[model samples]
Target chain A: MNNRNVILVIGAFVVHLLLQVLVFKDIVMFNVAFCFIYVGFLLLLPFEMNNMALVVIGFIAGITVDIFYDSLGIHASATVFMMFIRGQWVKLITPRGGYEVGAAPTIKAMGFQWFSGYVLPLLFLHQFVLFFVEASGFGLFFFTISKVLSSTIFTFIVLVLGQYLFYTKKASA
Target chain B: MRRLLLFLLRHRAFLLFLFLEIICGWLIVQNNSYQSATFFNSSNSIAANILSVSNDVTSYFSLRTENKDLAQEIARLQAKLDEKPKEVILVDSTTNIAEIDTLEESRYEFQTAEVINNSTRRFNNYLTIDKGSVDGVLPNMGVVGGGGVVGKIKYTSNHYSVVTSLLHADFYISSKVKDKINLCSTKWDHLDPSYASLLFVPKHINLQVGDTVVTSGFNSIYPEDVPIGVVSTVQIPEEATFFNAKIKLVNDFSRLSYVHIVQNLMRNEKDSLESLIQPENE
Candidate 1:
């Protein structure tokens, strides 16, 4: 990454972290749905970034939120697990034309339909792993699953809002 | 050797993922152990400082409700003062000087604190108070709100302390039915913050809806007769020896903003006296 891009990514991570800790940490909908906007940091990374680097970044991002949530390693485990599976996810969702090397898989880079298809599954996977790991027992099975479902929808809405507000579609020309 | 090197290089990402996952898993296990989890909780200085700043902004919204709670507390205290005794109990005045001096030396001292961070939705909820060891708050100190028992202090940093709230899983308070000899333990089921189950009440004891529950004073941490909750439901399982009473907690944890930490001044003395029966305990 160029110095400017690196600075922008770090700044984005900091903003996401601050939003997660200072704002979203207290926002619970019906005591189930939770907004985890920090996951956007990992999702918005450049497509061609190294897989190893992605996992490390995800771990760091997760731990930053974990520190504030008082959830020690739960978020780290889920985020890293999601990052580990991200490579396979990318291969599964590859377009027939394939991705351009420098492009990010954002709603702006790809069309809205493509972006929704790409992000939804990954978001659900992260939410599923996160809430289950947090619940930590089979006794909370139904409660945890409901939490995962609601949180996935809640996080996806926030992600969509963020993408539309900040991300711009550049001309292929 | 070249093939093996290439294979290792190719799978390095997966290997790193595995390594990080293991480390995080270890941390999760350590955190659940409860004894050494203090450093990873919100009571840690960095997290506490940040939350305190955020609380400063959000606490403004709750000012009206907090004022109401404070006013109610003052009224309760005023009523107690208004009910002064008509006559002195002691007829003899000779030894009353020494007795009065000892009575004035209360065993429990109260320290006021603001709850900068609190969560009720979590299964194991905790409240972070903006006072810590430096402010004479210590681990295991009993914390109470205007209505009733809040929790026990779990960890402390320089300027903050985490209370393992009454709504937490595995939290049990020794309690008794008001004006009754029945002693039982109360615990939250994690399903609801408003209710906790009173356990080990003998089946024959009659319990009414709205019967008061209070701290039993069996444990030195909390003083006797601190209101905990009111009986809301009574259940007796078939062939079971005990009645389970669900209590509606008086303190609404979702709106908790301020609390008082109870410091037992006579804790050392009480502990030393109790330890004589089990000399191995230090």
Candidate 2:
């Protein structure tokens, strides 16, 4: 919205991408699970941002990770799919009171239960599309599903921990 | 017309999503288009540089193992050299020494390279070597490592080349069982990096475990008699006419660090001469 918020968003994008490319890119657990915490950049964007903008941001983030992973457009396709469905997901999980204007749907703003409910499905969807696209196109069926499930859980844990460690609750709320 | 335009304007976001998704799908599935896709793959200069630097750091950890492999190779060569020299006596009085020497010239040139980037996890694996077109490396050259045949060069940038490893799904090499007339083709199943399958072996040929497979030299790409693997399993279905043979690869692909690209000097000549051979009457 404002100059400060735009700067903050850009800063977060760079930090998330750096960590993804430099750190998380190589973090394959037991040769099964991969942690993709960079999806947090899209998950935490301010509410009411245009869906088109969300998709573009998701594309940029996905491609950034892809450049390092050497998996062209696999992550981008999954990220775009998740962002395309994010609007419906938000409406489905909306609280009775509804989200406040200009507030990000983050753990600090939306509370632990709301944030988990909001993030879990989107995260799973992203990982599912990613691993399946990667596996079905190039690997076996059952092996890919296992990779998808394990990577989803791994990514979820990292995103939850990241939210708690980085964002604090609003004091005046 | 206005209504149609308004509908398109309203669903433009969805249209954009579909458009971008199509591009993504194209990139994922059509990664085999090598000419226009160097930038997206690891063969690009920036990606290759980063991988090379990382390899430099990791290569130190394997220095001891590499030394052992090098020692074993030298010992093998030394043993071959120490064997009794068998001189061929020129019985033909008309044959000159100069002409005979020219016939013995080498047909293949080799250049060493380091494996800067390699992967064994994917169905179609590729290796990036530090040597490229600038270093006399070219597409279609055969690569070999510590044990035996590795792969063939797929593409080459200025300073880097991408090798489609033998473990890739599409890689197949013509081989023969050592000391036998049996010829077969070998291919990886993408299930295990260390094992591959031997096809087209006749049912009449009795196969035993640990029979070595080597290049047949029928293909211009690889030299003859380069050891490829050894037979690990042989299965004969009750009514089948061919033997299903499993081979354990000689090269440890997962630990590959160094390789040599075989630059065949007579490839063009051989190919042209072979292409001129036509069927008798058909």
Candidate 3:
């Protein structure tokens, strides 16, 4: 990515982290659905970004958020795992012409159908690992599963809305 | 060696992921254990400061309820003060002077703290208070709200402390049914924030709905007879040895703005004496 894009991504990272801890932290619906909007930062990173860089950024973001949540390592492990798998997920869904270099996987960049396919499963996996690990095991199997599903849908809705409001359709570098 | 090096290079990313996951697993395990005093929690200065600012803004919305609770607390204290003289007169006639002197020396000291951040929807919940080590607040101290017991101090920094909320899955407090000597444990069932399960009550004990539960003070963390909750439901399954009872917690955890950290002044002496007897039993 270029210097300007790097700066922009960093800015988004701080914004997402701050909004997650300060605003979205308290907004749980019926004690099941949680809005973890910070995951959107990882999901929307440029496709061509280095896997190592992505994993490191995920670790930093997760740990910072973990401090605020008082859930040390749970968020970090989930985010890093998702970031590690992101490269493969991107490769698995390559379009016929392939993605443009340095293209972000935003809804504006990729159409709604492709974007949902790309983001939904990844968000599901992230929430799955997060809630189960926080609960320590499948001891509360059904309850934890419900939490994961609801949180995934809640986070996905917020992420899409955030992208629609803020992200502009920029030509790939 | 060359082939091994190639394999290592090919899977370096996976190796990093494994290594980091191990670290996270270690942190989760370490943090789950009692009183580890880690610096990565919300009690850290930067996170606590941000939460404090956010709380300052949002707390204004709950000011009316907070004032009402405080006024009620004041009225309760006034009522107790009015009865103190008659109790002292009866005690003077019935008890020895030495016993009265010992009773007058209060064992628990309370320090007021503002809750800067709190969470209730998680499997494990915590609250960060604006008081810390500098304020004489330490880990393992009991925190109580005006209404009832809140939680215990989990960690303390210089100016902030994290309390393990009573709603936490791992949290358990020694409690007993009001006016009955039978002791039971109060544990969060992880289903609802307002209710917690009362465990270990014998089947023969007559447990009724709406029975008040209070801290037994068996562990010396909380003061004896402090209001915990009222038993809301009691069920005895067939062939079970214990009754399955639930209590509606007295403290409204979501609206918690302030708490008092109870420091047991004689805790060190009691703990040291107890430690001396443990080895003999072993």
Candidate 4:
């Protein structure tokens, strides 16, 4: 809603997309970098972000991944599903004191323990939804489970890396 | 009504997200058209041309071996020529041999076109041969090379004819195992190139390893006794009434070099027979 928050989400979204297209595409080894880009959607949403904005962001995020992966829109479905579940997740994670004003989510904002708790659950959700959609299309349980597990591990690693690079305490949450 | 409108306004973003996702999913499904886009695959043509050029460049270095092989073939043919009976040459002039002219035309009565494009990886593997309508290639003709059976013509342009290779799951050649007298059709398993499967062979038939498999004269498309492959493994499940055998293909398409396409003078009659018989079953 504010200029800083809009710039933050939009900037992260664009860079997240370009990295998936340009950088992650070239890295062929473990496919870790691709899972991280999807984290941008989860990470950019504010503590008390609007449900509508979260859903919109989720669709954009999934479509961004969809364009590069060339997989017939599996990411979009999963990403929207993740957005729908994020509200309940926030309600659980948010303290009685509630979210601080004008502070974007980070280790400093929610503390390392709380942040990990937040990320791990949503990462699992996103990875599970995506892996299942793709695997369901193929009708293979082995492939689906392997994909979800591998993607979750990769997503966690990328999410941690994303936190390191982007999260900096401006005014101290 | 005002409350409903307010509820709709409140949930607009979720609705939009679903709409966008459905649109994107639909777009992706639409993009995956079954028929190959002629324009999209025109780039594949360029890639095929580049690949042919690249092969030509490397093949030029192998010219000595190629020439040696060609000369060896010529010498072998020449040796066979020596054994020909005297009256056979006289009778040839009185027959269809007189109608054919030109060095290229005389050799095989067909062009030895380079297989510029071929894919043996799909369920229905189609081959794109460099020979086309202009090169005297036509629909319903047969293509063969180092391997016994190559494919049949599917689509043709001025300079290319897409062939349905025997490796295609969609490929069903009316064939039989030579010497074994096992009458059945043959098709590839879509997994391996060095292997194919024989279908409709009755369980009562005797199959043996090293038994030569060839085209049955039942199909006019291919000359009888053309080698398809040998039965490597035969399986007859107790519940199954028909026998299925795995065949070891003689020609490995992965290493295809030169191919010989066969054109029958009476393809139309046989073609109609197949088409007429095809619908009767279904």
- Interface RMSD in Å per candidate, to 1 decimal? 1.3, 2.2, 0.6, 7.7
C-alpha positional error of residue B245 in candidate 2 after TM-score superposition, expressed in Å = 2.8
Quote the positional error of residue A103 for candidate 2 in Å: 4.7
Candidate achieving the largest DockQ? 3
Name the best candidate (by lDDT). Answer: 3
Estimate, for each residue in B1-282, the C-alpha lDDT of model 3 and write its tens digit.
Answer: 999999989988888888888888999998999789799999999999999999999999999999999999899889979986665454555555423455434989888999999998999999999999999988999999967999999999999999999989888999999876458999998888899999999987889998999999878899988899999998999999999899999988999999999999888988998999998999
TM-score of chain B of 2: 0.89
User: Model 4 over residues B143-168: C-alpha lDDT tens digits?
Assistant: 87664678777556666566667875
Q: What TM-score does candidate 3 reach?
A: 0.97
Each candidate: RMSD to true structure?
2.9, 4.0, 1.7, 9.2
lDDT of 4 at B205: 76
How would the docking of model 2 be graded? medium
**For model 4 chain B, where is the 10-residue window of minimal lDDT?**
B35-44
Query: Each candidate's fnat, in order?
Result: 0.79, 0.53, 0.77, 0.18
Ranking by TM-score: 3, 1, 2, 4
In candidate 1, what are the lDDT values of residues B129-208, reduced to their tens digit? Answer: 99988998888899998679999998888888888899887689999998764589999987778888999899778877
Off by over 4 Å in 2: A1-27, A37-48, A64-70, A100-120, A135-139, A158-173, B33-37, B87-105, B277-282
- The residue pairs in collision within model 3 are none
Between candidates 1 and 4, name the one with more favorable lDDT: 1
Ranking by lDDT: 3, 1, 2, 4
**Compared with the true structure, what per-residue lDDT tens digits does model 2 show for residues A1-173?**
88888898899898887677556765778667888878988888888788889888888788776755657788899999999889778888889988898888887777889888888889889988987776556457777777778888898899888877777654112
Chain A TM-score vs. truth, each candidate: 0.94, 0.92, 0.96, 0.85
Report the candidate with higher lDDT, 2 versus 3. 3
